[model samples]
Target chain A: MQAVEYFEVECPEALGGEYYKQIANDVLLDHNLLKVIDKLHIFIDPKVPVFVAVGLLKKISTRVRVGDFANVNPLEGKMTLVISDETYLASMLKIFWERFGKEKVEQPDRFTVILYNVPATPKEIEDIVVGDPSESLHKDLIYALRCIAPEGFRLRSEIFTGTKFTFVASENTLAEDIDTLVAEKFRLMGEVPP
Target chain B: MTLVPVTYKGGIFQHDIVVDLIEDLGGYIVQKHIIAQEVVLQCFVPREDIELIRQISRPLFGEVTDSPLVGTEIAIVSMSLEIHHLPHPSCDIAEYVRRLGAKSNMVSLARGPGKRIAGLNDEERDVINEHDIAVYLMGNFETCIEYKMPTLRRGIEVPIVLCGGPDKEVLERIIDPPVEGYVGNVGRFMRRTKEADELAKLDEIIDEITRVLEKKREEIAKDPLSVYPARLMGLIREQIPEILDVTSPTPLTVQIAGLRVKLPYDTFAERVKKVAIEDGITLGEVAEVLPSRMRDYVIVKVLPFSETNIAV
Candidate 1:
């Protein structure tokens, strides 16, 4: 789709290519995996009864940090945190309790948490990471590829790199040289992910 | 007399005579429901005498429309109830068929997943055979469909219509032994069919089903059943009062051959076998009350005139 930077579906016949493009578009959109993918290439060889899919993911930079959700004030004896977003507050509190003692980290109100006798500076506290979007990118990419693969193609081999992924599926067992086949699909798109 | 199915939509007033009229014309009342002050009746009447019912109902502000799909049940089958196939197209087709007053159900297979592994066992086939017709929801790729359909269609005695992504011509050429119809653009669906073009695809499936069902009705009419399923349903409901105690949507599901009574087969088979029509001929003598594959229901398939030599 136009949402992705580059998309191509190669099939033995033009009809299958056209129909599979629509199917892939619907499936990827249904899984909400379209925006995360930057480039994709799909090759369906029905005679060989194999489906290969490879894609390049966009740089996901959204990592929720302490400073992003709350304002930190360094008091005389304690550090005060005014929580603005509560979505990741639980995870943040879990991390705080592990770094400091459970008794020292106290939540006095729903939106205010105080730490007594904290050793770290405000800058170090603000840099504490709470949530990262790229952690689940591989799982989501594999799931989307599985949905796009033909129904009976259950046997699968998947490889996910930092910003690239490849999925190969077939009804039959994977052949001895399946990685070479997957690499060939990536070659169709001008780059073979290693 | 050829029977023409019709549905009556009007107020509750003057509805008693409608049943009497159908019985007098050697027809049968399929279903009737009175809610609030309105009444809806589904019945079949002699084709030549259908106008008489319309004429008699004019004064009561009743409208009678031909409902060919009445008294027949259809099954909307999907490979599985997974998110890929269910709710969108299978439920959509079933809802569309029900809109025309036919009874429809959604059936999901347990073992029909992979292309090479897509298959239906005898129990699944029997469940599908319970319906008058079946519409199978299929995938987009022709190659996968080619490998999968033969396995899926095996042992399915009832007529099957395929909903997939290939054009009708392409499907007709690829699939062997030809199904009832093939509708493209109904492949995997992510959204409900709300737009004009999307709904038009649903209409295409409905139109195809109607055509095949109409043709099936004609074939079954050649050597007609000794009794009307509508009348048998009425008789079963009247004699076996326990039938009404069931909680299913439709206690009795009418089909091309006969009716499916939603009661345990082992307990009610003997009682249903004794439901008599006009003469001393009980249901067991004229029909086969067999166990249904779906749960513990019973299906009654009345013998044709050639077998019973009796017509009412």
Candidate 2:
């Protein structure tokens, strides 16, 4: 298996080369995907009016458990969660309210949540999933790729997986030859076909 | 005499006094946006009478600020009204210009997509020419923008501003004749415009548009229009009360040479032509009333003193 490496953009159309690279970088930065993307490659041909992007995402094995963002402590009759990252506070409170009862969940401050009469242990509470970053990361990746694609290249096809993604867009209806073109493009980037 | 465009912002209470004062001063209210409690009136008041209107508005706790493009109309052109080209950036540009006080009309060309096949026809060009300035929102490619410019310049007489997604350097090299200015970073966008950088680019387009209008203003000053289009618009409103029934925004829409009354042409053209001024001279003698390019709206083109042998 080939290990993921770097990000690059190639344009046969001289004028679009630097412009495409700059925007593609911006879109990546905007989505905070620089860390998650191990390697990304984009190729554009303005004359043919085609846009293609292929990337390998760093694997994320763990879900965003409550413990990663908050400190869950078990009290005598209540469980108190002191959230370190306020980003997941709303979802954490909702999960507690749903799993326990709305009456059992009380938040006095912005980042502290207390739950009363909780049967679950600290480990169990800590195991509660707040969200999966990969889901939204995938979505943001697609959005960023779309932003980089030229506006008139409406016809699109995308393949998304746990660790890899490929998107190809064109002004015309994509033909079978496009797959061959994509393969040739990947070959140029020294990406071995699956 | 130069007319200044002013925006009056204040409480809605006793706002009619301000409106009445502007009307009495021969100023036309281009547009007024009123919520439950606040009102904003965009007015084109004569330079000599600006201080008078300001004094009235000041005592009423209303702020009067200059709105340079108040009565002017701008056409925001795009390739098509379809999902591919319309919403993302064109609508945002139109909304921004409208906020700046110009009456912005969104003009989408019939066959303005695909660089090889894109071309704008005469009618589309005429519609664009009617505005004080034309803003053509173009795509990323240099070749395509260069290809599209000739058709726009050939048919439209108004100054054109090319706004596109590419870098200014790339656009400047390609864009030629009839293009007043080139504004970059405004083309096809994927999301609702919120970025400060994107907004700054829109502001640049607005500034270029203002510059274009100023150039046209300087040219018009050489031999000014028969009457200030706004003043004529105000007169038409006062003389023809029937226009009040027209529900369109700015029923008496003003252009550089004339005004387009958004009333049915066949029934109202004769009445509009027969509108009399203070001299007992009818509009028919000083202007030509014809069917407008838009729906059945009547177009009143005020002839110059050289043509009509009458000056307002």
TM-score list, all predictions:
0.84, 0.74
True contacts kept of each: 0.47, 0.12
Q: Write the per-residue lDDT of candidate 2 for residues B1-312, one digit (tens) a residue.
A: 556778889999899999998888777787788978999998877789877877887877898887677777899888888655556678988999888788899999887865655778888877786677888988766766777667656768778888886777778887764367888756555456788887888889889998888888888777666666676676788888988888887888776667878988998888888877658878888888988676677877777767766767
Q: Residues B195-220, candidate 1, lDDT per residue (tens digit)?
A: 99998888788788889998887787
Report per-prediction Cα RMSD to one decimal.
4.6, 6.0
Per-chain TM-score (chain B), model 2: 0.92
**B47, model 2: CA deviation in Å?**
1.8
Off by over 4 Å in 1: A65-129, B7-65
- Best model per DockQ: 1
In angstroms, the error of model 2 at B152 is 4.6
